[model samples]
Target: MAEIRLAIVGLGKIAHDQHLPAVAATPGISVAAVASRNATLDGVPCFLTIEALLASGVEVDAVALCTPPMGRHRLAAAALRAGKHVLLEKPPGASVAEIAPLEALARDRGLTLFATWHSRFAPAVEPARALLAEAEIRSVRVNWKEDVRHWHPGQEWIWQPGGLGVFDPGINALSIVTRILPRPLFVTEAVLEFPGNRATPIAASLRLGDAAGLEVAVEFDWRQTGPQSWDIHVDTADGALVLSGGGRHLSRDGAILHDAPEREYTEIYHRFVALIGAGASEVDLAPLVHVADAFMLGERRVVAEFHW
Candidate 1:
């Protein structure tokens, strides 16, 4: 197996908890360097900025970008222009428009540019998709709620314009929705609830539809106090299909169907390696495009001030 020399561009929580471990376990990937403003990995060469990393002659073959969506485009573009394969974390960029440019850059450079949707790689999602494909779907509902303070802590960036607030997790639900449904769905109505002191919404409610008259409703909240829920249920003619635990478990008719260890990031890394080897790009922006469309179309309601 050819080892792909990789650099991690963000040293944040997701990088620490998921990316690092997954990359360490992947067969054809190696972390050659990392770039961050104030974070570092043990024994890994660290640079203060991406430009510095590229200037250091690290001989990296690919770059994984886990930075906030706001500044991701420029970094990914630079990496592709430098003849390196690029892996972009979920919610690929701050705006859907930006991703197309990066896509073009990678195409022009003949490099791989993958928009990683780790949630779609959950073990049970494929089974759930199979189950749903056979059903006459009537309606769908998604409930993704968690405590913001517990998940994000003092991370103030999430509340900013491009931070995505509740939609950060909500898009994960959208990614699964797009993957499982037999048809494509588009947003019909949406309402975003923003804290008075914040630029992004703390919660959102969305109504989506497909050409086949399928209706789907989604609710995203970051204020759940206990027993956080990440569930998606589909009503069908045969039986009810449920994907719970953020796609980790699947159930139908109140019986467990599939359950397995979550190896989403690992699968993501493997896919990245395959894309690089094929000299192809896997760029799907439906999830992020819907997000930006929701933001553009949804009515905003200001609630109480949020502090963390």
Candidate 2:
């Protein structure tokens, strides 16, 4: 019941911008140490690797793995085996196969392993899910476009094999869609636009459907300029439901329903703490599974070169 002594594993942009601030604001939690090869947080012990952090005996109750998906599995397994709860960032692992063993390990050890989908904590997501629960669904359209240069900046690992390309942000949309809709959705057809110079796609268009013949069209692009957009439009027998601003704002029939401040990371920490207190783990792989299915079944097209 005392303050959870947490250590952050990656000191990247997301950790500095979101995780640090969220941890500071949340009660009953304190950042005890950090482990990153190239970055460090002020006033905390920094280690070059998770192995070093564990061997140093820093006495951390939990660790948040903010590293890229490529290295998440190993770091998380290490933390869990060391008798510490683990919090994984979005997409969890590079592939679906990498997550099962870690989940099993955590379950067997009686430790909490939280695969956090931060977007699910958005203000409008729950409301949208609640409303759609009673409405007869017709169709869904997701348009998630943004300029990657502005958002990613110098993040080169994004174009690598496990980087997830545009899906890095696109997965956020998928997470919300999977949560809000009443039925389970799976990819039927997909087209990926990969740059000649990169291993990942710059854009993707997917057609997803469930058993009830409900089809949803999704578009993800990293080439948008000027005005950025993250909107999901759902059409049902009742009317139109729009979730714009990345699930921060919701509207029905063009009338505002819910719009509030964003506190995704804060809520994520809260959930992590609760899970630790309850001695349980929350791991959802639907969004990541949809992504893996897309890769297995989707057709790939080579596009013009993309430069940072």
Candidate 3:
């Protein structure tokens, strides 16, 4: 097998918990180096900044960026300009418009640029899409709520501008929704609840629709205390479809359809390998477009301040 030497940019929780392990388990790819401002991996060459790593002439063929969405464009563009394939974590960039130029850059350089939506790689997500594609969909409701304190403890960047706040997790639901449903979706109405002390929304209520007038009601909140809830319910003319456990579990009218362990990151890595080998780029911004639309059409309400 042809090997791809990959460097990791950013050593945060997601990189350690998901990207590292996935790359280790995947074939044809291995971690050659890492760049992080605060953390380092044992036995691996680490640099303070991406530019430093690229300048050091490290033998890296690909780069996975796990940093916060803000400032990622520069890092990714740097990697591509240095002749390396790039994989971006969810929400691709801080904004929808920024991703296209990166795509064009990769195309001009003949490098792979993958804007990955990991939730779409969930075990049941494709099955739901296959099922929904054949059924007559009637309605959709997305309840994506989670405790930000437990998930993002001490992550001060989450409240900053361009951090996406609650939509950080909520966009996962939108990714699956956009993939499974047959029709294109657009936001109709949105009510965003911003914390009195933060620059982003803590909770949001959104109404989305397609050309045929199919309505999708969405609720995103970062205030749940107990078990995190990541569920999507779709009411169709055939039967109701439920994708829960962040796309890990799926049921049709209460009968289990697809349930399995989550291998989303591993699958993402495999896709990355294939794309790099084929010299192709997979950059889909539909989910991020929905997020941008919500911000554009939503009404803002200042809620109580959040602590921790």
lDDT of 3 at 55: 95
Candidate 1 Cα errors over 4 Å, as ranges: none
TM-score of 1: 0.98
Q: For residues 234-303, write the lDDT of model 1, one tens digit per residue.
A: 9899888899999999988889999999999999998998888888899888898789889888999999
For model 3 the local lDDT of residue 20 reads 94
Instruction: Give the candidates in order of lDDT, highest first.
Output: 2, 3, 1
Question: How many clashing residue pairs are found in candidate 1?
Answer: 0
Q: For residues 1-308, could you state the per-residue lDDT of candidate 2 as single tens digits?
A: 99999999989999999999999989889999999999988898999999999999789999999999997899999999999999999989999999999999999999999999999999999999999997899999999999999999989999999999999999999999999999999999999999999998999999999999999999999999999999999998989999999999999999999999999999999989899999999999999999989888989999999998
Error (Å) of candidate 3 at residue 43 is 1.8
**Model 2 regions lying over 4 Å from their true place:** none
Per-residue alpha-carbon lDDT of candidate 3 for residues 195-265, written as tens digits (9 for 90 to 100): 99999999999999999999999999999988888999999887888999999999998999999999999
What TM-score, computed on C-alpha atoms, does each candidate reach? 0.98, 0.99, 0.99
lDDT for each of the candidates?
0.92, 0.95, 0.95
Residue 113, model 1: lDDT of 91
Decreasing TM-score order of the candidates = 2, 3, 1
